[model samples]
Target: MKITTPRWALEAAGAIGAEMAGTIAATGVRVVGDTALLSAVPEAVEKVPAAPRIAPEVAAQALYGALAAVASAPVRHSAPAKARTVHQTSSKELVRVLGHRCLKRLRRR
Candidate 1:
């Protein structure tokens, strides 16, 4: 017995394959089937010192302070809505009329 993959599955696989091939070519990486080979090992650079760790209590306090600051900030209401122009209104009406006409035609078919 033979099993066949669905057309959509094949299409999706093809798209993914194309994307992977493009990415590999763009990045100048060499690949043999599933395995990727590095052309050269990059030289190691001196690492920057990591930031000092904050105490749990200090971190908690800072988080609470930030939340409190945000909560206490005044809320600004948005400005009133602008009036619609004749062009905008007419376009909307036109779309509604066209949509109804299309629906009527479709139903009659």
Candidate 2:
């Protein structure tokens, strides 16, 4: 008995493999099937732009400055809370109210 993979599954795998290959190529890294010989393309390396590196000291100083600015900022006080009017109902009253609504619904049906 021969077990075969679905066409869509094969196509999806091919697409994913192609994308992986493209990404690896874009990164200026070469994958060779043979382990004996490996070569790097200088042009490929030059093609990818290097990101600017920030010094740790400068980053720390900027972070500290931001924190200090935030700490020195004035604290705004909110107005006092207004009293709330709450109508509390007992469990028995709630059940009675719900039962009346259900009866009314059933009568209409």
Candidate 3:
């Protein structure tokens, strides 16, 4: 039978989680701590399609691995033009508040 990951699982994992999950699947047997070997956890997790259902240990490994890689990457000191423009946008967005009247209308739906 063909196996595929579900939409809900992908959504929960988000961009980062999806990458991490893929890594976990690719690296079947990984050495976690000094004496701990996560040889079977990834395989067990792959048998299932849901991300949330994955074992905590496996998930932790994926998250840590992804985070560490990101942390070690080189940093860019300058922001792109688009990002700079957005950062300098008007402060109107911060002051605007949707009062009770707007909330009541939304609740009707």
Q: Rate the local accuracy (lDDT) of all candidates.
A: 0.54, 0.51, 0.48
In angstroms, give how far residue 85 of model 3 lies from its true place: 10
As for TM-score, the candidate ahead, 1 or 2, is 2
Instruction: Summing lDDT over every window of 10 consecutive residues in candidate 1, give the lowest-scoring window.
Output: 35-44
- Write model 1 residue lDDT over 14-109, tens digit each, in one string: 666667667887887765665222222234345566675988899977855554454444433233226544454454444444555554564589
Candidate 3 segments exceeding 4 Å error: 1-52, 79-109
Reference-based lDDT, residue 19, model 3: 61
Preferred candidate (lDDT higher): 2 or 3:
2
lDDT of 3 by residue, 1-109 (tens): 4575675554554655556656776788674543212221222235544456778999977865554454444433355546666455434421222233343454588
Candidate 1 RMSD to the correct structure? 20.5
RMSD, candidate 3, Å: 20.3
Candidate 3 backbone collisions, by pair: none
User: TM-scores of all models?
Assistant: 0.27, 0.29, 0.26
Sorting all predicted structures by TM-score, with the top scorer first, yields 2, 1, 3
Better of 2 and 3 by TM-score: 2
Global lDDT of model 3: 0.48
